[model samples]
Target: MFSFYNGFKKFAFAMDPETAHHQSINLLKRFPLVLSEVFRNENLGGRYGVQVGNLHWDFPIGLAAGLDKNAEAIDFFTRINFGAVEVGTVTPLAQEGNPRPRLFRYVEEESLRNMMGFNNEGAEAVRTNIIDSNRNGKVLGVNLGKNKLTPQENAKDDYHTLYGTFAPLADYLVINLSSPNTPGLRDLQQKDTLLELLSELDALRLAFPKPLYLKIAPDLSFEDIPDIVDVVKEKKLEGIIATNTTIMPERGAGGISGRLLTEKAALVRNKVLECVRETPEIQVIGVGGVSTFNELWDFWKAGGKAMQLYTSFIYKGPKVLDEIKHGIDSVMAQNDLKSVQEILDNINHISKP
Candidate 1:
């Protein structure tokens, strides 16, 4: 099956990237149940199960946000080998996103640059899709982003609305104030604004308490990282997704993901983990540029409890999840470690200052 997809990938890449994405989603949407049953792996999860915050994931590798932006593939994805499948960057109101030529691929770098400005069918539609679908009892994370037209000051309101809408159905919720495509969105990452947003959301969570995680960017300076970590700790947050994507020139315009982000992501994940090591309440869900065993090891070495994948799924196909899980299991055995947690525990203990 992987061989077939690998070959199909060449054909898919020949077309416009967004068109290929829709064509792929259309296939899954057409035969979701059939695909679910075909790809179901009953024995794939137990050995790698983990409890981050209040949720127990079947494994550590998750399908990151942006792939299934509208929760269209939740049923299909959850049936596969991933520990979790995150859906959306769902907004309060749907928008067309940036423009036509938004998504691009650099085959040599195995990276993607997309300024897809949170295009989706909005929060209510996504929530309904999840409620109507067969979730397969797998962990489902909903990544929430504000509407593009919403003023920066009212941004927290958009998050409040999305949080209310998604929290009931989600295993966890992500406040995605980090996507570089949304104009002035990354400004939310500024210390005062970030704190205000976190504070507002934290207060709201008291009413419907669920694990809330923040997705940050890889391009942030080292000086700004500790403050981000501090906010998570102070808010009594559940986890932090180490990064979104990088905005760099060499990788061309837009947020760069995949191979280009590997090193920077590790550095960011390590810094966040190191800062919050003393606080077990905040688990680190490493993202960005992780598609291989060695990269997974770097994340674990950096004290990441779990990881997520986006662009890699585009380049490598669904088999990437199993490959990564097997790689983790193999590496654990090689080190005589019982599980990924053991490696994380060791990192936490050793890095304690």
Candidate 2:
């Protein structure tokens, strides 16, 4: 089956990156049920499930946002091994998003750079898509972001509206203030602004409580982490997702992801984990440059739980997930572990590759 995707990649890779992305999305849109059969591991999930706040992921690894920005393929993603599927950096209104040639690939680095500014089918349309799609009982999250046109001062309004729209629909909801593509988005990560922005949602959260997370960037200074952590704790949100795509200007504009992001993202994740160490209620979902089981192992070692993947899925296809699952199976077998929670409970006792 990997050989099938390998051959298909040759054709997909020949075209522009964004076009290839659309082509793949369109293909999944057509044959999701069939694709689900080919890719899903029904019982594997029960063996390896991990708790993330109120939600339980079938496995630790999930499909990150941006891959399915519009919820177009929720049926396929949730059907596969992905423990969870997060769609959208959805806005209040439909956006065309920062012109073409915005998505670029670093083939050798197995990385990507995208200046795609929350280009998604507005909340109403996407909500309709989610209402129509089958989540297969797997966790489904919607990553919310302000529309490109929404002013910084009114940023809370966008989030408030998105929260109102998705809370009942999604298993969990993420407040994305991390993507570097959007202008002035990161500014909201500042402690005062973050508090103010999240405070606006307190009323809605009380009315309809949902597990919420603030996704932060890898580019943020280490000193800035505690403040963000404080904001999450103060807001009584579920946890934080660290970190989002990084900006490497030398590589050009937009955020850098995959291999290019590993070291930097890990640093931020560790910092976040360390900050939240005293507060077990807060979980840090490691993202960025998460390729194989090694990264997941490292994250577990640092007291982190589940993480998400984007670029690695592009470079290695579904086989990457299978390999990671195989790795978990082997480690658990060797250590006489029963479940993923058991491994995490005795994480330091387990052997690593």
Candidate 3:
């Protein structure tokens, strides 16, 4: 199956990246039941099921946002064994994302590059999809952002509106303030701006509570991490998704992905953990370049309570989940670690200051 899939991937690579993604998603959607059964039997559940506020996730390995912008294939993705599926960077209003050829493949680097500017069918449409996805038991997270034409100053209102509409349907909500594709989105990550946005979001969550996680960028400097930690603590946010794609690549304009981001992501995860050491209650979802069991283990070692994969799924195929879960279980057993949580605790004890 994997060989056939790889062949398909190779064939897809011959075409434009964006087109290939659409083709793949359409194909997956066509066989949702079969895919789901296969993934479930694989037992690719994460080391532990984690609870974030009101949401209980069966695993740490989740599908990140951008894969299903419109929430069109939740049934298909859930069937493939993700612990959770974060759909959309959906805005208050729907709009075309970016010009043609917005997505590219860097095959040599084993990476994908895209400036897919928050393209989606809008919050209302996505909300309906989420509400309709009740058949799938997998956890759902909605990643929210402002529309492209919306001014930066009005961003908060857009997010607020989305939260109001989608919060009821989502197990978790992600504040997507880091996508380079959206102009001025990263500006919201600035200290004062972040505080304001989070404060408003925190207020919203209080009125209508849901697990809220902030999705950050891997391009941020080590110094920027503490500011984010402070805001999370101050607002009493549920958790943090330690990275979105990075724009600081030496090569190009689009955000980089895959193996190249592994070490940097680990560093950021370590920094975030360090910043929140005294407050171990705050969860961190590590993402960025997690392609192997070892890299995932390294993320856990670095204090990530949960993790996510994107480019890896693109490169390694669906079986990657089973491979990672089985490999980690073997390592944990060999090391006399009784559970994933126990292993994480041990790693924290050794690594924490």
Candidate 2 local Cα displacement, residue 109, angstroms: 0.7
Q: Residue 24 in candidate 3 has what lDDT? A: 79
Clashing pairs in 1: none
Q: Would you list the rank order by TM-score, best first?
A: 2, 1, 3
How far is 240's C-alpha from truth in model 1 (Å)? 1.0
* Order of candidate numbers by lDDT, starting with the best: 2, 1, 3
C-alpha lDDT values of all predictions: 0.83, 0.91, 0.79
Which is the winner by TM-score between candidate 2 and candidate 3? 2
lDDT tens readout by residue for model 2, 1-353? 67877987899999999999999999998899987676555457388899998789989999999999999999898877898999998998999899878999999999999999888889999999999998888899999999888889999999999999999999889999999988999999999999999999989999999999999999999999998999899999999998899999998899999999999999999999999999999878899999989999999999998999999999988888898998898888889888899999998777854
Q: What is the C-alpha RMSD of each candidate to the true structure, in Å?
A: 3.0, 1.1, 2.8
lDDT of 3 by residue, 1-353 (tens): 66666787789888788888998777766777775554443654454665544666676588888898988789888876677888898999998988877887777777888878887889888888777764368888889999989888888888899999988888888998989888888989999999987776666788898878888998888898898889888888887897888875576676877777777877887788788778877888888888777776677676566788888888777777777777667766667775666766677553211
55, model 3: CA deviation in Å? 3.6
TM-score of each: 0.93, 0.98, 0.92
In model 3, the runs with Cα more than 4 Å from the true position are 37-41, 44-48, 51-54, 336-338, 348-353
- Ten-residue region with minimum lDDT total, candidate 3: 344-353
